[model samples]
Structure formats: C-alpha cells, structure tokens
Target: MKIRAAVLEKIGAAAPYAQSLPLRVQEVELDPPGPGEVLVRIRAAGLCHSDLSVINGSRPRPTPMVLGHESAGEVVEVANDVRDLRPGDRVVLVFVPSCGGCVPCAEGRPALCEPGAVSNTAGTLLSGERRLHIGETRLNHHTGVSCFAEYAVVSRRSCVKLEADISFAEAALFGCAVLTGVGAVINTARVQAGSTVAVLGLGGVGLNALLAAVASGAREIVAIDLNEDKLALARELGATMTVNASDEGAATAIRTATHGGVDYAFEMAGSIKAMELAYLITRRGGTTITAGLPSPEHKFSFSPVSLVGEERTLRGSYIGSSVPVRDIARYVDLYQRGKLPVNRLMGEQIGLADINAGFDRLATGHSLRDVVVF
Candidate 1:
C-alpha cells in the first residue's frame, strides 16, 4: 500500500521548514507485515533530537530516509505468526528489542537485544531492505517503523501495548526521550529517596529525567540549560533549582548551590563540555550518568587521575535501560496518577505536512517534545 511520510533526502538539507533541500513530505510505498510483524496505523509521532541530529549531519544516516522513531498507534493488522499482539490493540513503538530469548534480554537488558542490533542503521528486519520510496530511489530505512509515515510495518518485538485513554502522542514519547531519561533515573541509577541530583540540559530527555528524579524522591533536582525557555520548562517538570549555562559557568554554579556536589548527575544533551560538567558536579564517590548521544566525530577529554582519585564513576546509558514489558506499564500508571505530567510535555502538535516545522522546534531546543500526527 502507499503511505504518506516525511523523507530526508540527504544530510545537511533543510527540512520542510526553511528550504526544499534535504527534508520534505512525499507520498511513498509501504510493504505489508511479514511473519512476526504487525502493521501499525500511527496516530501520533514525536520529532526528537536524534532525528534532527541525523538531518544536521551530526548523526550520519542513510539518505532518502523516513525520519520518525518515536511513535504510538493502534495495531490494524498482525501477521499470522505473531501472537500476544492482536488488531485494535493500542501500542508504543520500540526499535531496540527483537527477541526476549536473546542474550541481552535474558540478562534483563532488552534494550541491548542482538538481533535488532542495528535496526536503526540497517533500517529493516532480517530481510535487510526498506519498504519506502521517493520517485525511483529506495528511501533509506530508519528504525524499522519509520513512523514518520501514516502507516508502518514493524516487528512484534518493536511495540509495547498501551492502555486506552492515554494520548498516542504522549505514548509516543515513551519510545525515546521519556524512556531514556526516566529509565536512566529509575532503572539504571535506581536513585534512592533524598538523593541529591543534578541534570544537564533541559530538552525532552532531560525534562523527563527531572520528573523521574522527583518521582524517585530526590531531595534536590538541579537543572542546567543554556536556554532560559528550556530552564523554565525544566522547572515546570519538577526541578528544584535552575542554572543558566549560557554565560555562567554551570559547573561552578552547581557546585555553589549544592555546597560541593550532588550525589548523582545526569547528562542528557549531547555536549562534551556538559558531559565533563556532569562528571565535575558529582561529589566524591558520587555517580555520573552520561545519557547523551555525541556524534561519531566528537570525543571528550578527561584525566586518568580524576577517575581514580575522585572515586567518581562515569557511566553511559542508551535508552535508559528500559524494559518495555515492565517499565512502559509502570510509567503509564505514573502518568495516570498525575505524577508524570505527560500533558505538560506537549509543546506543539502538527499534521504530517507540518512535520518539517516540528523539526525546526526540535532544532531550536525549546520544547519538551513536538508531536507529528498522521
């Protein structure tokens, strides 16, 4: 069947927003679901930082690609071989999990499942091909679902069923930013009550981290951001203190406020300096979690002595150690309890045509998240 989607023809090209260069909306073709797969009619999708990074050439990806990864929808059809998932079921898309019996999944690390290892890079299932097209060229596939389109064919392992009454846009966030941030705090760090915490960057992922720290009973949640608007959003998301990193030395400011350092620091923005600050702000023996995705070309510099003497440990996290089966449900319950503030995270909403505009919002780093509805 044919599908409508936003296609990024190449890197460094402007999305539908400024010029007709790398990104634009075009009608494309889609394949039917394969075995162990389900066809999802996307209700809503999010314009996340990673999507923008790929477009800006920070995160290089195949061109003529369908741009969305964070999305939620109802299952319109499920393959004959697929079980446990049926038509009419509401679900959130996850590109990182393929099999529950894999080595990673068996160790309670579904996010590291091997079979779907490079789904975002390889852009397809085991067949190793995409189902989208622009004119004659095969559009490069991204994260199997490529949910920028109205309909997507995805493996059953890539989706987590959601409860009714939850907005698909909000559910879509659980796929990426929300999962990464909240999972970093709750799943990876396992922050204890009254733990002093600091978060670097107040974008979608960082805001979710801020909220999760609050839910974890953190005593003080210090948020840092170069943009004041994002800092304001961070405060709304449950930050107890805010730091403007534009002109001020953020690390020094955090140190001043916390009277030395915090027990835990999380880096959500993909900045090398910010990652260093996350390390610097941790007290002796304090843990620092790096949740940002730096470009392949970027690298950080740190001294060997700092790691050994400060007794501080720096760790990296991808997708926040999220376990879809258990954590997605737990977060949904938190949302329903009015604790997660899922509604407040909605910065803007646009149709598939306005998809490029949503990308602009993400580039400016102002909103918690922008939704692209099909």
Candidate 2:
C-alpha cells in the first residue's frame, strides 16, 4: 500500500509549522505484517513534547526519519496468526509493545519489555526493516506506529482496540501523556487517600498527574508552574493549590501549603530546578517522581546523607509504568466517568501540514496539546 507522510528531511532546520510542516507528500510502500503486525489507518494523533525533542536534536533522531509515536486509528489489516484483532477494529497504538516472554514482561512490567526498548528508540520495526521509504532512502519510522501521516503499520501487540463510544482524538493521548500521568499515580505511586501531593510544572503530563492524584483520593494537590493559564486549568483538573514557580518564595510557599511537606511530589516540567524543588518539598519519607525529560548536561543537587537519613524514595517512571492494553481502556473509562476531562487538555487540533505549530506552542508554553488530525 502507498500513503502520504510528513518526513523530517534534515535536523536543526526549523520546520514551517505555523503554516506548513515542509512535509513532502511522498508515497511509500507498506509491507504486510510479518508474524504479529497490524496496519492502521490513523485518524487522530496527539502531538507530544517528545516528538519536538527529536526534531530539535535533543533526542537525536536520524535524519529523514518518520517521527510520530502517540496516535489512534483503525485496524485496516492484520497479519496471519494475529488473534483477538481483525480488520476494521478501532485501535490505539502503544509505542512500547509487550512480547509477554521478556524478563520485564514476566515480572508484570510489560512497558519495559526489551524488544521495545532499543527498537522503539531507534525508530524501527521489530524486524529491522524500513516499511517507509522514498526511492533508495529507507526512512526510519518512530517506534511501531508512525502516525504523522494517514496510515501506520505496527505490531499487533502495539494495537489496543477501543469501545465504539470513545473518540479517536481523545484516545490518541491514552498512548502517551494520559498513560504516563495516570499510570504514575495508579500503577507506580499507588497514592492513597488523604495523602498530600505536589506537581511541579503544569504541562500536559503535569495536568494529568494532578488529575490522577485526585482520582487516587489524594486530599491536597498542589500545582507548581510559571504559567497562570496552566495553573488555572490545573485548579479545574483538581489541584487544591497553585504555586507560581517564578516567585522567589515559591519553595517556602509550597512547604507551607503542604503543612511542612507533601507526601508525594512529581517533577514534570523537565526543569533541573523543579526537580530540586520537588525533592526539597517532600516530607522525610515522601516519594519524588520525576516525569519530565531535561537536557543531558542538566544536573541537580541532593545531599546523599540527608537522602539516606530521611528514608525518602526517589524514582523515575516510564510512560507511567503502564501496560497499554490494560491501562488505556481503564483511562478511557475514567474519561467516561467524568473523573478525567481529557478534552480540556487539548488546546487545538491542527492538520499535518501545520504540525510544527504544535511544537512551537509547547516551546513557548502557549498550548496544552495541539493534536494532529489526519
């Protein structure tokens, strides 16, 4: 099959996202799934900060790569031996696919499966072949799903079908931000009722973290951010208090609001200083979860002696430590039950030609999620 896609021709050159993506509409061949694979016709895709990370060279994606990870669509075709999936099934693509036999998978950590670790990062299929290419240039697609275009060929394990009631636009993010934020609370932190939590940085992930904290029954959810617009949105999403990070006395104010310190703190802005503040404002034994992606050279300070004496837990979570198949459906249910207002998180929906606008908005802290609708 042949389809159109927005290819990142070179690195460091700015894409014309406000008007167009410099996306040359090229037709490429898509091989039928080998072993366990599915071909999806992408409907809607959530524009993630990670996608911008690759284009900006922070993630170091190979030139001329097809970079898209979070998306939702329908199964147009399925490979033989693919059980529980068939053509015409609506599905959400999981960037990380579970093989079910890997060590991590056996330990109930399917998101950490070995196959997805290297392959997903390298922007290739498990078979190590390029299903997307133009002429002799075999472009590397991001993960199993490259939904920046109209269609994506992914592993059957990566596709999770949704109920007829859930909209594709909303379900698109279940593959990334929603899972990362909600899963961190439900599956990773296991936050309990009456606990106090602080979320540093009110971005897409931060907003989800606050909502998850509320869903987990945390009594007080303190939101920290420099954007007043986001802080207002955070409040509606269940943040009991808001902190302006730009203020000189923000740290002291956070401590006061938490009644000395919070039981849990999440750093989602990917700022080095935010991470430090997250650690500082936590109670002696409170947990600190770093959900953001900072620069490689960025570093923060923490006293090892105090860290040990306090018995505090400092851990990093990946995509909310989620099993996509199980958690995506659960989050969809959460949205239906009115516990999560996912639509509020979306600031706008732009076409593929204007994909770069989404990234620009994120860079300037002007938008929540600028979804890509094919």
Candidate 3:
C-alpha cells in the first residue's frame, strides 16, 4: 500500500525547519505485517524532541529514515503468531520494542530491553527486517516505530492496547512524554508524598513530571525554565513556584525558596547545563533524575566528594523506566480520574502537511505537544 509518510533524507539541512524542510512528506509503499508484527493505521502522532534531534543532527541515526516514535493508532491487521491483539484495537506505539525473553524484559525492565536497543540502533524491526520502500529505495524505521506515516508495521512488543475511551492524542502523549516524565518520578525516583521537588525545563515532559509530583502529593513543586510562558503554564498546572533558569541568581533563588534545596530535582531539558543545575539543587541524600537525551558527545561532570558525602544519587531515566503495559494503564486510570491533566499539555492540532512548521515551533520551544491528527 502507498502511504504518505515523513521521510528525512538528510540531517541538519538548516534550521527554522520551515525554511530548510528536512522532512519531505512523500508517498511510500508499505508492506503487510510479518510474523509477530501488526499493521496499524496511525490516528495521531506527537512531535517529540527526539525526532527533532535527529533532524538537526544533534542525535545521530541512519539517514533516509522514516522518523516518528510517539504515536497512537488502531490495529488494522495482525500477522501470524500474534494473538493478544486484533483488528480495531486501540494502541499506543512504544519506541522500545521489547523482546519478551531478553534479560531486562525478564526482570520487568522492558524499557532497557537489549534486543530493542540493538534493533533501534540498526533502524530495523525486532526481526531485523525493513518493511518500507520508496519504489526501489528501502527506508529505515525510527526506533522500531516510524509512525509519522499513515500506516506503520511494528513489532507486537511495540504496542500497548488502550482502553476504549482514551483519545488518540492523549494515548500518543502516553507513548513518550507522560511515560518519560511521570515514570521518572514514580518509578525512577519514587518520590514520596510531602517531598520537595524541582523540575528543570518546562517542556511537555517536564510539565508532566510536575503533574506527577502534584499527584504524588509533593509539598513544594518548583518549575524551572528559560521560557516565561512555560513557567507561567507550570504555575497554572500546579507548580508551587517558578524560576527562570536564565537568571544568574536562579540557583540561589531555588535554594532559598526550598529552604536549602529540593529533595528531588528532575532534569527534562536535554542539556549538560540543566543536568548540572539539577544536581546542584538536590538536597543531601536526594536523587537527581535526568530523562533528557543530549547529544552523545555531550558530557557533564560532578564532584565526587559531594556525591559521597551528601549521599546524592544521580540516575538516568529512559522512557521513564516504564513497563508500558503496566504503567500506561495506571497513568490512564489516573487521567480518567481527573488526577493527571495531561490534556492541558496539548498545544496545537495539525495535519501532516503542517508537520515541518510544527517542528519549527517545537525546535524554537514555542509549542508543547503538537499532534498530527490523521
């Protein structure tokens, strides 16, 4: 079948993506689901920074790739050996395609699945095969889910069936932002009720972290970001305080506001500076969790003595350390109960043609969660 998909032919073609237009919307042929894979009709896809990183050459991936990962769709067809899901089932695409037999999967850490990582790096499905072609040219998948297209063939492990009432846009958000942000708090950090929390970089993920902190009953929630608009939105969305990270006195202000420092500081802005600031604001024995993905070449340093003496813990949270099957359902239930208002994160509704412009806003930090509703 021929489907309209966003194909990135080159990386870093130039910025203000609207001007450079790196991702060309073109018609491509897609294959039917193979064994252990399912064909999905993508209903909605989110514009995540991870995709932008690839376009701008900040995060390197194989070129000529179909780039999209966070999405929600309906299963249109199921291949042989796939039994748990069927046609018409609502599903959210997971970036990591977990092989159930992997060591991490066996240990209930599907987010760290070994085969999934290898397959993602290879730009192939879990079966190590490509299912997309542009006439004679083969196209690589993005994180096992090239969901920017109208249809996607993905591994069974790449999807989580959703409840009937959840909207595609909301489900798509669950695929990345919610999972990474909320998961970082509840799973990685295990933030306690009445704990002090500070989240740096108020983008979609950071805001979701703030929401999770609020739901967890945190006494103090400080939102840090360079954007005043985002900081204002953070305050509206339950942040107890806000700080402009651009301010030189920002660190001191945060320390004073929290009476020294917060119990947990989450860095969601993919930057070494943000990580350093997050580390600085964490109280003694507190945890600093970073869910951001900076360029592989980027690195940050820490004081070894402070880490030892203060007992400060630093950890990286990928996909929020989530087991999607379990965590998505739990988070959705909370969303239904009016606890997690992830809907507030939605910024714009756009068609696939406006994708490049949407990306420009995303790259410029002008929009939160822009959705391509097919």
Please name the candidate that would achieve the greatest TM-score relative to the true structure. 3
Model 2 earns a TM-score of: 0.95
Candidate with better lDDT, 2 vs 3: 3
Which of the two candidates, 2 or 3, achieves a greater TM-score against the reference?
3
lDDT of 2 at 305: 79
Q: Relative to the unseen true structure, what is the C-alpha lDDT of residue 202 in candidate 1, on a scale of 0 to 100? A: 79
Task: Name model 1 segments beyond 4 Å from true.
Answer: 14-17, 134-136
Which lDDT tens digits does candidate 3 get at residues 1-374? 99999999988888777888899999999998899999999999999999999998888999799999999999999997999999999999999999999889999999999999999999999999899999899999999999999999999999999984988988899999999999999999999999999999888899999999999999999999889999999999999999988899888889888988999999999989999999989988888999999999998999899999999899999999999999999999999999999999997989998899999999887698999999
lDDT of 2 by residue, 159-249 (tens): 8888748778888988888998888887888899999999998777878888889888999999999899998988878888998888898
Q: Could you tell me how far off, in angstroms, the CA of residue 343 lies in candidate 2 after the best superposition? A: 1.9
Overall lDDT per candidate, in order of appearance: 0.82, 0.82, 0.93
Give per-residue CA lDDT, model 1, range 195-233, as digits (tens). Answer: 899999877888888889999999999999888987887
Q: Model 2: which residue pairs collide?
A: none
| Candidate 2 lDDT for residue 82 | 84
Candidate that scores best on lDDT: 3
- lDDT for residue 222 in candidate 2, whole number 0-100: 92
Clashing pairs in 3: none
- Runs of candidate 2 exceeding 4 Å displacement: 14-26
